[model samples]
Target: MIRMIIPLAIFLGLVALLLVSLETAEQRKLVASPLIGRPVPNFTLPGLHDPDVQRSSADLQGEPYIINVWGSWCWACREEHPYIERLGNESGIPLVGFNWKDERQDALRWLNQFGDAWTFHMVDFEGRAAIDLGVYGAPETFLVDHEGIIRHKHIGPVDQTVFEDLMRRIMEMRSEAES
Candidate 1:
């Protein structure tokens, strides 16, 4: 009878542990990227509108800007597209785009259909630059400072709250730079 009770206790303990783990997993959020506070990765990709025009991390220096990683095929990008357009227009922040792993024509058409929010778009056709940037998926955004350092990374769509947070961080970075 004692031996049978021990087995039952062990089974109950295992069930409790599994239940706790499941609950924790449901509450988990996306982890913050370690690349925050680091320099932007080196990359040169062609412009989406004009392949002959290449943009690089070097060219993005001397100004605070937002690099939005998107794809024509990404539905989440569509959801965030209008907000991004508003962000560029309202904040006066230069919104650069990294068109990740997408066809140039499809991207162009999508932009034409949705309205262009990007000040300029870089074509990451082969996704090499996206890989270097540690991109997990489309619709990620990185806030880069005037010195070309990555200050913040947002893993999902940039809604009003996210944009507000981004602006706050940008202002903080600017103040830090001035001081």
Candidate 2:
């Protein structure tokens, strides 16, 4: 009857909508950060390896660099470590390792086991600076341009495709600076 058909049609439509949403879930995970195009948040955090030494945003102002927010406890950060290592060694861009909300010893242990790839390693034991930078979670990367403006943000793990995209963007930024 028409009544039976109407119920079936509604159920099928709901299922289809759910399927579409599931299909695009990965794409949806990459929500653009509001900090894009804005200057890097100012912070003076101590070095991870040596707390006595301090690094600040002001010091990184003249060069394009990457700020990778990660914690020793994050499994996703482990998954992305190789790609981050590649970025640091091959990208020709300085990478600032922002160790967020982690115990100093654990962060150092993780780096020692995995190999440190950062141009500078800074610690944010309380994550206050990360809050200013709009960090949602670990493994977030922000690419800052030469003038210290944030040009791109990648949420979650950086795999091969993401690495390629970041490399391309870095190249573009360099060319833009040259002109």
Candidate 3:
């Protein structure tokens, strides 16, 4: 009887440990952020505003730029639209958008209703490009240096404070490069 109880207790402990391990693995997937201080991905997709303008990962190069992944279907995108305006207008970082998993017509309409703050918008109909960028959801912002290396990533809406802080950090990077 004593042996039976000890074995059962050991089994229960193993089960609890397994459950914890599984939960931790799942959380890692959801919380996995982009690998900054690395080269940004390279690819070209159709532009939302202009078909002639080739929006590519290479565009992220040659300037301190901001790549914002957004879709009309994403509620967070709508919430963060205004701050994107601040980035384009205030910070002057060639802001661009990845229109992930969105219909062309709906995207255009949404932009028209809100505001086309993006210097350029990529029409990512399938979200393949987004997967390559390690995007978990819309409204994720990446800061790339002039060399096209990702410096930082911000998840969720960008408010005034967030925008300012990012801008400051980007400016610091510029100064550091100059020095």
The prediction achieving the highest lDDT against the true structure is 2
Q: Which candidate ranks first by TM-score, i.e. highest?
A: 2
Model 3 spans with C-alpha error above 4 angstroms: 1-34, 176-179
- Model 3 error, position 25 (Å): 14
Instruction: Estimate, for each residue in 57-162, the C-alpha lDDT of model 3 and write its tens digit.
Output: 8856767888888888889888878888878887656887888888888999998999887888887777787888888887899888888788888887788788
RMSD of each: 3.0, 2.3, 4.3
Q: Rate the local accuracy (lDDT) of all candidates.
A: 0.86, 0.91, 0.82
TM-score of each: 0.84, 0.88, 0.78
Backbone clash count for every predicted candidate, in the order shown: 0, 0, 0
Candidate 2 residue-wise lDDT at 85:
98
Tens-digit per-residue lDDT, 61-87, candidate 2: 877889998999999999999999999
Query: Which residue pairs show backbone clashes in model 3?
Result: none
lDDT per residue for candidate 1 within 1-179, as digits (tens), equals: 99899989999999999999888884466666778889999998889888998788998888788899999899999998888888778655688999998988899999999999789999988888787788988899998888888988888888889878877887776676567
lDDT of the structure predicted as candidate 1 = 0.86
Query: What lDDT does candidate 3 reach at residue 66?
Result: 82
Clash list (residue pairs), candidate 1: none
Error of 2 at 160 (Å): 0.8
- In Å, residue 41's CA in model 3 sits off its true spot by 1.0
